[model samples]
Target: MIDWRQLREIITTPDNVPIIGLILAIAFYVWYGLRQARANDRLIREVEADPGRHRKTQPYEEGWEREVQVWPYLLRIEFLAALIVTLLLLVWSLCINAPLEDPANPGQTMNPAKAPWYFVGLQELLVYFDPWFAGVALPVLILIGLMLFPYLDASPLGSGYYTLRQRRVALGAFGAGFAIWIGAILVGTFIRGPGWVWFWPGQTWDHTRAVYETTRDLPDLIGLHNGVAKALAGFVAIVLFYAGAGRLIHWLVTRSETDRRIYRATSALQYYTFQFFAITILAGVPAKIALRLLLRVKYVLVTPWFNI
Candidate 1:
């Protein structure tokens, strides 16, 4: 069980105020889900009572009624938006001073030395993965995922409108990822102290505090620790997991002939590759958490070149 006081202390920090953005994002999704549920219920009831009421709705007329000219009207709105953003930034800059540490010294290293707030999430991931994997490979995969998302997400629902019911999977995945990244940044900024020890808000930063977390490698967990054997076992395990999951998804999800045709038309190998990368990136967090909590397994595929 987590110590609520410790967790709360980690969260409740002046420097960690931006973490509220993540909380707000989650709350917004909760509210959106509720609203979408109510909307769905109403639509179902309406359809049952009068099936033809909404069915006969004509195509949207994209004339003056549905369109706005890009003149004084749109221009004025855009100007006000920019003005408000600029004013907010000006006020924020005035109120909060930027954090500037002491001048760089080659010999004097700051314990828990963090990247900028934006990159803090990736930095924190170094705890779970090797520097090359966390700092380089994952970041490259994220960029690839972003570039490949539109191709993967073929759904046409919620294109212009903001409805959770229409785009639940996409939005939920993105929101969860965003929350994790923000949460990592918050932890790095507020909870981590000297030597990267976990420190709460009320607790004093004890420089001598030792955080000795023993992490078991994947092969060690399954009682195989020979280097070559472990590497081969790890590779086989990952391949099996990926292939099993892909087969399960392919079998379980009932797709139409047209969908199958589309899949055939596209590069199926590329599609599966992208899907695997996406799954690993998104599911890795929860997988890591579960392993740490249940088995005290720190790294899954630990090799010389990479660790996850």
Candidate 2:
């Protein structure tokens, strides 16, 4: 039977409220953005088919100036938007209580002690990865990978417009990462219960629940017993993954003629940099998650210095 009370408690938690809001807001924006992108793509196709006819992406009366004054036109919209947001915040503050708890006591630690919602994704990673990797290395890699995107993307299309046909690869990579990050946050907030145990939305939070599942390393699964041998096997596995994933990503990103042209234009340095980040961050996150959750594999790469 479903534990509705437990689910309600979790959903109503002050700390979780913003996450719920974020999910809703992101869903709306994604739908709206994709809808507009599709429309723009269609318009582009029509324009290309018939260049003799002049067409604007947005329909405007003839003789209307392409640009409007920023002082009243743009600032008026911005001011209204700011007022709406401010009013919403004011209402929210009055309705919902702040997520403040009693002062911390060493003797009374909260079960499933979680970070703030924003950092909860990283906290969830700790369950599947080593502390150094999940907490420090992964976060740094994500930031660097994000910063490298503009430098790596050679596409001139979709600069001033929203269109999937023009920026599929770029959008797809970003979307996948974003989806994974949001999924982690959702799981950490709602699925994790007391003692950090997995609990479905309607499942009761069993404080006394004790799970004793044994997790195995990748090398150990294939009968590699010696320390040096296990490390070698793991290193080989990581290298193979990178090699295969790079090829797969390259094929996917360079399928279209335009994409292939962009690939040809990209420098060797840029291509390699893109592959490194895409394989490690894009392909690696889901791969590790599958290994950990499905295969119960821990530490695919283990060495004296660190484990991943």
Predicted structure with the largest TM-score when compared to the true one: 2
Per-model clash counts, in order, read 0, 0
Candidate 1 structure quality by residue, lDDT tens digits, 32-141: 76675556556645766987655212244335275668998899999999999899879867876665669999899887676766788888777766787778998898
Best-matching candidate per lDDT: 2
Scored by lDDT, model 1 comes in at 0.67
lDDT: worst 10-residue window of model 1: 55-64
Against the hidden reference, what TM-scores do the models get? 0.75, 0.97
What would the per-residue lDDT of candidate 2 be over residues 231-278, giving only the tens digit for each residue?
Answer: 999999999999999999999989998789888989999999989888
Predicted candidate 1, C-alpha RMSD:
5.0
Clashing pairs in 1: none
